[model samples]
Target: MQTISAPRADARTPVETPAPLLHSIVLDWYRENARDLPWRTPEASPWAVMVSEFMLQQTPVKRVLPAYAAWLERWPTPARLAADAPGEAVRMWGRLGYPRRALRLHAAATAIVERHGGRVPDDHAELLALPGVGEYTAAAVASFAFKQRHAVLDTNVRRVFARAVTGVEYPANATTAAERRVATGLLPAADEVAAEWAVAVMELGALVCTARSPECGGCPLRAQCAWQRAGCPPHQGPARRGQSYEGTDRQVRGKLLAVLRAQHGPVPRGQLDVVWPDDIQRDRALDGLVADGLVEPLADGYFQLPQ
Candidate 1:
């Protein structure tokens, strides 16, 4: 995949404030049509919101729903998760893929327990300092969970901004410094309003301004959308690369983890060897898992999830 060359921050054009009607329209649509996701519920805890953000990274919402519920039901708070063995987190993660996220969540839970008194912090910097919480996750938890005024720029929100504000079919392949300025400029002045605006824009993109086939007719911003006004041009930049699963190390890792997860304790090295035929790839996958802290080896020829 070609790297997208975004203009330097100084050279980028300023983003105009979206019309007030734009907010009302999108917000109203969100209020009515937004998916009844558990994370968005009034009763959802800050921890729940943060967990959802972690699970939703590259995974879809549908796959996340059951896992998210089971996770919280088992470990209702950061303290609970922190107290449990890390292997349990991995087991409960259950085919979510990128099982390392489960490990990171466990680490983050431990950090929250030690640093924040088991509370998911509202402060962006504190959230960022937690394991696996990056700029987007921190902003998401701060904005969606705590209702703080931060620019929450995920893939969905970026798509919304690209089409509605920038008249582009897609955002730059990478989140550039200039994109940060665009999000900042368009943020509402009032903190509460800005928070609502953030999620509203994200919801719009998820439901309406979708990546491959946007349902433009149902979009609240269709009438005023820049992309619509300009006749919705196709993406002209570098070709987007599709993630291939076949014959990949990721697939091998998942197969290895599945074997581990099916058992209650350590498995013999020979047991793991039978999952994949390629000796080198299988060995590389096992080594990668051990390096990632997802697997631990005993003095004997037995492998287990981290204790």
Candidate 2:
């Protein structure tokens, strides 16, 4: 029996080579098959892209679509959002979950206004300096909005790369520099257009090469996929921790925020109590909301969205 060794860190592997086949195949497929997400449209503004990215951090597209449109409609630009109270952003966030993202987005808008002259900065480092922007988001904004050459390595992209390059069903816990190198190696030569290719690859990962129940038959890269050649083995790594929504503080927090969102101003403790039966749990949830800067206490014993 013969055994195959994994590619070494220093080896001049085929995966490291600028495989035109991979880029052309993925980009060509993307041109015809990409989802008509509003943010991906050519007319999307930087502010719109930034908002979409932030809203999409944990929320799915189906949930984010209406909220994204409503958010931009209310606060069209960084200056507009920055001018409004943080409370308004919280209210606008609705039941999107992770309400602190709303506060951070508000802070980011203010920072963009004060530091970047009311425009989303094109520089990756400058964008990363914003409140909620991380490596993936910074690269996403730079590539999607600014049309720069950056490897946008999100979970989907990481999975795609792991399967395509290393024939793995899943990637490691966190992205490493090696992953970046592999992604960069696959990037197209033209910096201006490379961003599109990056987005196309990410779209493919999200829509086709999903974590569970991947539609391998319909995948565009089926012919060239390393995982397909390797017999499409099941992922055997440590299982990812599934999120618990029921009986958790997050659920209570969402319930509290939902009541506040429906109301105009301060909501009484009695009104909030109806959402959760447990008094201690409700109090803890409200306290967590306050700690997270998503809620504030009013003159009476009422709670309001943070100002």
Question: Candidate 2: misplaced stretches above 4 Å?
Answer: 1-18
* Per-residue C-alpha lDDT of model 2 across residues 121-204, encoded as one tens digit per residue: 999999999999999999999999999999999988999888877788999888998888888877777886689888988888
Report the C-alpha displacement of residue 306, candidate 2, in angstroms: 1.3
TM-score, every prediction? 0.93, 0.92
TM-score of 1: 0.93
Q: What's the lDDT for candidate 1? A: 0.88
* Cα RMSD of predicted structure 1: 5.1
lDDT, model 1, position 304: 95
Task: Look at candidate 1 and tell me the lDDT of residue 242.
Answer: 76
**Each prediction's Cα RMSD?**
5.1, 3.9
